[model samples]
Target chain A: MVGKHCILELYDCDHAKLNDEAFLRTTITTAAKRAGATLLNLITHRFEPQGVTGLALLAESHLSIHTWPENGYAAVDVFTCGDQTMPEQACELLRQELGAKNHALKSFQRETPAALATAVRHPKA
Target chain B: MVGKHCILELYDCDHAKLNDEAFLRTTITTAAKRAGATLLNLITHRFEPQGVTGLALLAESHLSIHTWPENGYAAVDVFTCGDQTMPEQACELLRQELGAKNHALKSFQRETPAALATAVRHPKA
Candidate 1:
């Protein structure tokens, strides 16, 4: 019933690596493995002149990154269910791998199954 | 620079429908289109016991949802860059499609390209 989700704003990332689609594709896969999540598939797309977006579909949940190389910023999300998935560790690893100097993180504890189920069954009128 | 991202916590979702994979896939794809995003691919997976995870790889950025049908809750992320992509509209469409009775949303203005570039070049020592 206890789980966590981290929404990350990574700034001052290495402009070069952020612009490299291959690097982002590989980095996210490694990040997911680092978090101990089973990787399902990694999808990546490189924008016209710059920027890259990568999404890692994982067995536990999902981790995604969208980078604006020209801006040296990347937005990352690591959402996992259960206690086994360590999203914070994955976020830290990515900050280091991407050479980001500053970041803002928002973390939340997902609602327990029992609590959510009850709300659905007994909706507020 | 002025773009937005919506981090949504959807509660009181339809438990039965949340477990269905096809419905989620199609819903997300349509959600992206509703946001004026060009779809790249939509990937979905059904868990062993229950729940579903769907990721929409959009040309603008990405949209993803992780459902805990057992919990009657779902986590949705709508991240899109530039003025052309309307993440709020997409989030609203999803709230309706999922039949969520209540939801919490967190929105933010992504750092501008010029601002992020400045931070990278002038890193704090």
Candidate 2:
């Protein structure tokens, strides 16, 4: 299967009042829906009164988010397969929601076995 | 805040013989440890008599795996930041564990916000 994934590292967030748990759940569901992801199940854990983290499995792929209340930072990862661009859209939504001042993002393409073999022979610079 | 992530999709797996739930948990933890991920908390769900899926949040990043017992297929995603290549290493371990004959993989670089803005303007063809 071929897929695209995005990893986001959000820094300088205002976590003290961002409704951590709610934000995690809402962001996952909303992003999944917006990207037309077929969600199978979701589970979230709120670490006492400090941080919150969650994971959602979707037919298209998956979405995960974590928050650090003390440091005012968070991280998000979204992966999707099929005819959709939900990860990118979700990133935009998260950017707006967190009111993040600065961030670092990365993307990866999971290559098929055959292609990967070829890639190893001729690595990308 | 730069990181790397890998997404894997396995097809034609042996679901009946393979221990779905056990595999899910083992793969997540082992892969995380091998990748030098700092474990935080892990949660897994087993869909009665059928499939299993799990998520592990690591200080380095996160690991997620899902198994489709009926179709003998599974998907795994591993992402890590810092001076590590755990995602790739984990993919290799998974391939060996699942006895997967064929597969597809892809990788992406999530440019920092500033780089992303530049990428958007220049675009990658």
Candidate 3:
């Protein structure tokens, strides 16, 4: 499995904007669509004080977000295993939608053990 | 917000073990509790061919996993923001529960913009 996993820390977003439930939901769903992820289910939870967590379960993989409005910060994680998913493009879309001033991203390539072992077996080939 | 995000790629797990819905659900839920995360909601989806996707939404943060049993592989994402949460401990728990032969972990620190910006402002204090 080729899982292009992307984790993003979005900073300095508008506090009010970060707290909007609808915006968070739609933005993640749209990102899933942009990434070519087939939506299986979507859930969004709003905290008592002021924060939101949204998760989109997809056939290809999943995308999730957690926001802290008080600090105007949001954390995002998008992992897709299929070949077609565009998680990076989705990140750009989210940065714009959240009005984040700056952000950091760390991505990982997740492969199956068999594949990794196979690579180790044929280091030169 | 200090978000300690851990993403794991578990390889060569027992396929039949991965297909057990209850185990998948409990593994994640327990991991949350171990991390001192308050459970908000939990959901698990089983794919047709042979896989499972579980998401545990916690007040402190969230934990999720997607399994590819055919490859003896699983992908895990655990993000916790509170200072009390012990994400690494949870990882060790999962590793034992899944009986993963090998695994890879990549972590990121998610900070609120104010905190990150403040650091940039004061370079050294």
Candidate 4:
């Protein structure tokens, strides 16, 4: 089955929130629920100085967040396979919850083999 | 910090191997090690009819696979931060281990805010 993947770059986020382990864990869980994804489990790691990385395993797929608190930045990935889920919704929730001033988002569809066969190819750069 | 992200699409993979949970778990762990990434933990789930989804939490970042055995296709994502780790190496190892006849890969850098500001922008489609 094909799926949708979103790569979100959040800029000028709240540094404190980004570094808070509990906050990130909650935010990701909430974001997954908001996106209509079934959260299987969440695993997080807090860096020594400052920073947090969190991943949520979903039945549909996964959602992850990696934060650079010093720069007020965070990178998020949301990929979900069934049509019932909306990955963009998860991105928006993260943007708002993380207090990002400006964000860049790239969304693309993962194609199945049959569709990929017919898809246009770009020569390796 | 900027990180490299690779989106890999495998076609004509070995169906039995794709559906095997144990094989995927070992393959992904070995692939991560080959890329010089430290493994944190791995979580996997197998679908009812025939399919498998596995995610490996790495100290550098994460690696994930979602397979559709009946279609002989598997989708993989590998994202890692820091210059020490090579995400592409992980992708190549997976391509070989999965026995994919043909594969498509897209690689991009997730830039920090400063670099993102000056980078070319593509208007929404």
Once model 2 is optimally superposed onto the true structure by TM-score, how far is the C-alpha of residue A12 displaced, in angstroms? 3.1
| lDDT digits (tens) for residues B1-125 of candidate 1 | 54477888888889888988988988898899999987887888877667788999887678989887887788888887666788988899989998999988888875544553333221112
Best by the lDDT measure: 4
lDDT of 1 by residue, A1-125 (tens): 45577888888899999988888878898899888888887888777667777888887778989887887788888887666678988899889999998998888875545553332221012
CA error at residue B47 for candidate 1, angstroms: 0.9
Structural similarity to truth (TM-score) of each candidate: 0.84, 0.64, 0.86, 0.88
Q: What's the CA error at residue B30 for candidate 4, in Å? A: 0.9
Task: State the DockQ of every prediction.
Answer: 0.24, 0.08, 0.25, 0.18
Clashing pairs in 4: none
Pick by TM-score: which candidate is best? 4
Off by over 4 Å in 2: A17-19, A47-49, A113-125, B1-22, B33-53, B58-60, B66-75, B80-89, B101-125
Cα lDDT of model 4 by residue, A2-53, tens digit: 5899999999999899989999999999999999998887888877577778
Look at candidate 1 and tell me the lDDT of residue A70.
80
TM-score of 3: 0.86
Model 3 docking tier (incorrect/acceptable/medium/high): acceptable
lDDT of 4 by residue, B1-125 (tens): 35889999999999999989999999999999988998887888887677788888887778999887878889999998777789889989989988999999999988666643322211112
lDDT per residue (tens digit) for residues A34-117 in model 2: 767766767766664455667787665578876655656677888776544557887777776787888877776654333322
Interface RMSD of 1: 10.3
DockQ for the candidate 1 complex?
0.24
Can you give the lDDT of residue A8 in candidate 1?
85
Query: What is the DockQ score, from 0 to 1, of model 2?
Result: 0.08
Candidate 2 Cα deviation (angstroms), residue A78: 0.7
For each model, chain A TM-score?
0.87, 0.80, 0.87, 0.89
